[model samples]
Target chain A: MPLGDETIVLSRRQAEIGFAILAGLAGFVILFGAMEHDTGWSRSGPEAGYFPFRLGMLLMAASGVILLRVLLQRGPSEPFLSWGAAKKLLAFLLPLIGFVLLIGPVGLYLAGAAYLFVAIGLIGRVPWLKSGLIAVLVPVFLFIAFEYAFKAPLPKGPLGPLFGLI
Target chain B: MVENFTQLMQGFAVSLSAYHIALMMAGVMFGLVVGVMPGLGAPNGVSLLLPLTFTMEPVSAVILLTSMYWGALIGGSTTSILFNIPGEPSSIATTFDGYPMAKRGEATKALTFAFLSSGFGALFGVVVVTLLASSITKFALLFSPVEYFLVFVLAFASFIAFGAGSPLKTIVSILIGLALASVGMDTISGSMRLTYDIPELIRGISFLVVVIGLFGLGELLETMQNPYAAKAVTTRLDWAEVFRSAMIWPRHYASLLRSAIIGCWMGIAPGGPTAASFMSYGIGKRMSRNGANFGKGEPDGLVSAETADQAAGSAAMLPMLALGLPSSATAAVLLGGLLIWGITPGPTLFREKPEFVWGLISSMYLANVVAVIMALATVPLFARMMQVPFSITGPIIAMICVIGAWTVAGAPFDLWLLMVFGVVGFVMKALDYPLAPLVLGMVLGDRMEDAFRQSMLLSGGKFSAFLGSPLAVVISSLIALCILVAVMGAVRRRA
Candidate 1:
């Protein structure tokens, strides 16, 4: 439950470098747009982009300082993400992305049921019958609750008519 | 004052009807389910329900939504006690002590105390709203762009005051949020700033989608991935112990009162419940005779977090009611609901439609009382959920997140944004950056920008006019001091 060493895999320095670079790049992008929109004061005073422009520059400088601090620090460091935690994160998150992608073509209801069955029966290693039942029932419940009770229709794919009773 | 009280009593007459009570109960129950679920929180719950409000009366709609808000805050602590996973960000502090109590086989005691303290806090918040109703109305009616802008600045400054992260990180996070907020077409000039020629990007990033991803999916990804993180399920349901704790809670009156006041101030100031929770708990731990006893299953710590969270959640309505300003994400969604219902929330709301405003204020009290009773009755049912396998629970959460994101705009693009922010949330968490400020920034960012531009236009481009108002001067000075202190502290630590 705690974010302890067990979850830490990357060295502190590596994580710091990665975050700093990302932030610094984002800052540069922001600054670029801000400058293009006229970041300086105008005839009326500060322009639309004026405040954001300064904010972007500050982000870059602050991130640079952060990178420096991490580099210079001599104290002992902890790993950012442990190996086991990394595997778990990827295993859980990657399949979730796949499920989300399938929603467009497969429909939310169909994709959700399939995702549930596979995630529960296969990845979770639960009994097939129970997982199948849950996979079927939850979508049905959501259909009734959302489509009928609330009258807020969810995304319907090709197979949407299969559960139109609700 | 007497007239407002009489009107408030009439408001209560409206709220106490059987039909309204049933709605309140349903709202509370739904809110609890949303809160007990790991992937949903107050903002997500309210936004998801916004669609259903279209057909209902404005009073019933506000009552339902606000009761759900109350239920969500109370339900948030349940998971914190049982699973060491905060159902909402504000309950993160509760996990510090509540989980320890659960581990010690006092799950019912912790739940009882948390629910009761939360109820008390809600009452305190309602009392404040009742007493300050006229004054708040006056303030709202009189406030110019200058006062309102200062209030927004105070909201922005709060992130720094409340954030424990490095000032640079906070600033960077806020800037990113502000930049993201600017992505949609500019409301003022109708000029697109960062849409990148994408049709879907025209609406900019929906705060609802971004939040569902950041808090809901991001949290699911974290604990669901790590099997080792799961603890042995604790399922003690002793009514006697709970009753005893409830009976004894009033003895800790000092902490209860102090935390209530702290929560009220934070809620009013736009500091949000998370900050209030942390601040209240910190103060409780410091002032308690059992200071070192905290984080070791201490009751007072749980009380502090619970009380402050609810107090702040309830009191957060003040700004929304008085000024149409939302202090938190949930409040923002509630404001959105108000707009949808064609009920403009401002000073005139009091004079023009006392029934709507007073009805809402009265229902808040009833909702808190009802939420506590509902929460107590259903604690066993919710506790059973914590024992359910994550395999089943995890997918359900993902489905809910996807459904919530998809339904908000009924746009598939929101699902994509949800996915993107989920990863963004993961990375931010992996790097120890706080997510609350980012959320606050996103919600307050556009408003702050608009306020600034308006102030600029009003001043006719004179930046000094920002300093012309005493209120603005005070708030701006506060922000300056916050940055200066943060910088000085960093330098001192380095030296």
Candidate 2:
């Protein structure tokens, strides 16, 4: 994961502009949502949306300024993400997404083990034996720590009843 | 003051138990591990451990967390001196002189100076907190909703003025946080504000979940993009040399005092430890007699930075306790923890939970000593721990983040929120948007809104309600001044 010379994937200028636009759009959505309820003062006090409505307006204003500044900027923009960096980030992130999604169906322990096995063995290129050991040991440790020691339950999913841990 | 002292003594009685002492030691050790790790910081470490504290008493929980904070601060400097990698952000300045000194075969001297000075700084900070705690709380007790709202304004305004980064970006970051906080239910009106009719949004967004995502997974992703090898400088600590280095503490008294004052001021003012350390380092370089030797390897440079960093880290706790305003991200998380534990921070907390307050304050005194000793004793152990490949630690950390998120409210939705915020955190970091303001915003959003709405109701929706009282007038003026200074500074920079 050490940085090396690589071609640009996203330029800083583009990122700035894109994110600002997205934020501005988010601001509009928030403002529109605020309008669903009264955004002004009522007989009791300020309405639920009063503070958020102002926040939404401020967000749009701030983001609009950012967008304008980036759009008008001159000279070279640095690379926001190089190709190699993006690839590396995705390699880690995609699996993380998979792990989170898997948690719903398989529970935390199994999902965690599966994620670690793939992450350490396949992506990290560690030897299978060590990766498998960590993959198994970590979830077991977490199960004990969370369940028995802390008395807090994690999502144990379908196999929970078999282990009687849920 | 006498009453405070009496309460403090009673607090000592509560915290001196074998069980509490053991928790302090365990916390420091765990914090050291977190601090010595690059991607895992004090805030993230504390939040990750928060779920476990649910079953513990508030006093015991606080002792553990605060001790961990002390350990992490000390642990961060270890990697700075040993590996030229700051385990925590605040220790970045330590590397300026700490690494160079270590490279010159004075590893023992550097570590000793860092540990001793940091210990002194933390002690000084805790003492300040102890002395000022009563007065500040008493003053805070007089605050009306107008003043409280102004306090929140002042906090954000100070960030724009004193914080490093674009003020607009800071504002945007804060707005995003406030918006996120407003999601789910409006506590005041009992209406849904920003949930977009989603069932998950009804519970409101938990700041803890966001914190885990931003600092935990976001930092991990950032590290993946630009990884560095951790090659530690191997050095055995000699007790005689350490004793000899400790002998020269008096020579740098001026630097220590100056840095400690700067650190305390920054901590209280919301500049935070990272900024305080950097500022102290810059000022030390200019003021010290050995100024030219700063980067190459100056003991004073390392001392000043480490002292200020730790001093600020401890002093930031004062405002969180007294004013219910968190000056740093870690403090904000601790404040959240306090909230979850059913202890509301403020002047009322002091009046209501004297045992909890004093116990925590007393623990600070004990914890720093324990942190310094533990840090010195376990350097080799942590140094070995650092060698564990990131490939293994990375996935383990991600798993911790997932587990942390799931446990916060046990909602599957929070896991997804964690992922979303993780990406947002990464982008915010890359874009140079200060994340502290956002965290602070999330922590204080509801409170600030409550204050504002209450004030409005008090004044029948009149805007002048904010300026009604003299105290409010003064705080409002300060907030205005802060924004003005920021705007002027921005204009001058552009010019």
Candidate 3:
């Protein structure tokens, strides 16, 4: 039941307030964008902005209510995320972010392999040999399955030209 | 009725090919894996497989998808019984009694009962769909733009009335979904609405990418906060125990029937399988003769929950097909798939594509049978797979999600979008905001807008256009009633 090492990084109340404010900002942006066009009922019918304009208002109103309720209510401030949990999340997420960044330059196959190797070996603390095996095998399997069987081409980056996969 | 039967016979001809049967088996197998894993689910599983079905015939594609759904429903119960972990949200109720039964060395019996009752409930649900398909389609054909818009309102209202969340938060979630859906080109006025001058925004945010980020990567991130160390109870399948469990089915016939009916009603009303299973379990505890021993490894409790879960899962298809209203997130994803295939879901679908409609229905019958057999045969395999550490499985799943998002439109921008939605999904779950309404809104937003505009055009731009017909009046009143009930309930709880 212990989710983390028990040092609270953010409280539930703070997170709620922050999110509500962000939503309000998003609502304002939507409204601002919506007003670029005619937000009215023309002779033809309701204009395009008419629907989105009302939607923006409704979003702002809903978030405002949420913000007000959270502010007015008095309660215990539970931990939203602990330091340990945050560290764990970052460990998983950072590599994923790297994988996404790597996808554009190295293609899906190589980036995927590199991601699997690091994630499994370093973060997961698995044995290097097994991690290397999985890193190599999975992408190969995906390559054959996607390229040959399904014929849905995935991004291969430099590897595509080198292997004549493109 | 005779005509319906004849069409169904023709549907059998379309779906009964050897190739289609193989697809069912493969889909079910994949579904079981997805269902057994705690993070992966039917919605994620279906979305991941959606791109693969792009080349397939609609009937074959749907059969594959529906078959995977049946397999996931059945697979979800396996983890609940063996590991006391519900793989799918709908199967959470099964753990109340299923885990206890497994602990008492009746794992085989518990699993058999769960699978058999699931099959029974699914069969019951399909029978209901078969009988009511024509009538529902007929009723839907009478709808005008007013009625269609009202139906959308009714769907949202029912979510608020029945949702186990704060109404304000649910509204915010729904509004966000609608706002996101309106981002691309405006179909009605032939102008851009909310693109914000971004090139990627012109195509709009793909719901498939949203789904991949939200349910797929979002679940992985959440699961990482507290990883599951699965301690599975080892049990080999015994034929004698299975036969014994099958023989006792008649004793719990009333519970099974009652739960199936509850499930069907909930499915059609948009309460969905998670709610249906819990409702059936609670009601079964009150009504059963074994009520005294309800939660302590009671067979009737397991039966009630599993039956209702599968029943609702199958029965939810009716609304999605007949009215273009998906009652669950997975069904919403399927609705998205239908649109991708250029087949508009509604009453006209029945008239124009009898083979497609009937083929899907008939395949349900075949898929559930295949699901039961496959679920039983592969229990040990999945149970072993569950023993793999989350660290390894987690990365693999994340990789799969990345690939899935990329495949949607092969846009790198979607990968970024996927990341943003993942964060949103995790935060929303932590805050107890319902995700299903958001998904429902995203799927139906454009259509709802069109219905509203068309209604305005029809009624000469009057706000009173919604109540122009008696059917519209009834729907509007129902929406009002749902909101009233929710308000009164909230007030009473506060007081």
Best by lDDT: 3
What TM-score would chain B of candidate 3 score versus the native chain B? 0.99
TM-score, predicted candidate 1 vs. hidden true structure: 0.90
lDDT of 3 by residue, B282-397 (tens): 99999999977888999999999999999998999999999999998899999999998878999999999998999999999999999999999998888889998998999999
Kindly report the docking quality category of candidate 1.
Answer: medium
Give one digit per residue, the lDDT tens place, for model 1 in A1-166.
6665366668867887898889989888878766657666666555767766876788899788888878888878876678777777776777678888888898888888988988888888889999999999999899888888888888778877766643
DockQ of each: 0.51, 0.82, 0.82
Ranked by TM-score, top first: 3, 2, 1
How good is model 3 by TM-score? 0.98
Report clashes for each candidate as comma-separated counts. 6, 1, 0
TM-score of each candidate structure, all chains considered together: 0.90, 0.98, 0.98
TM-score of chain A of each: 0.86, 0.93, 0.93
Better of 1 and 2 by DockQ: 2
Ranking by lDDT: 3, 2, 1
Model 1 chain A: weakest 10-residue lDDT segment is A39-48
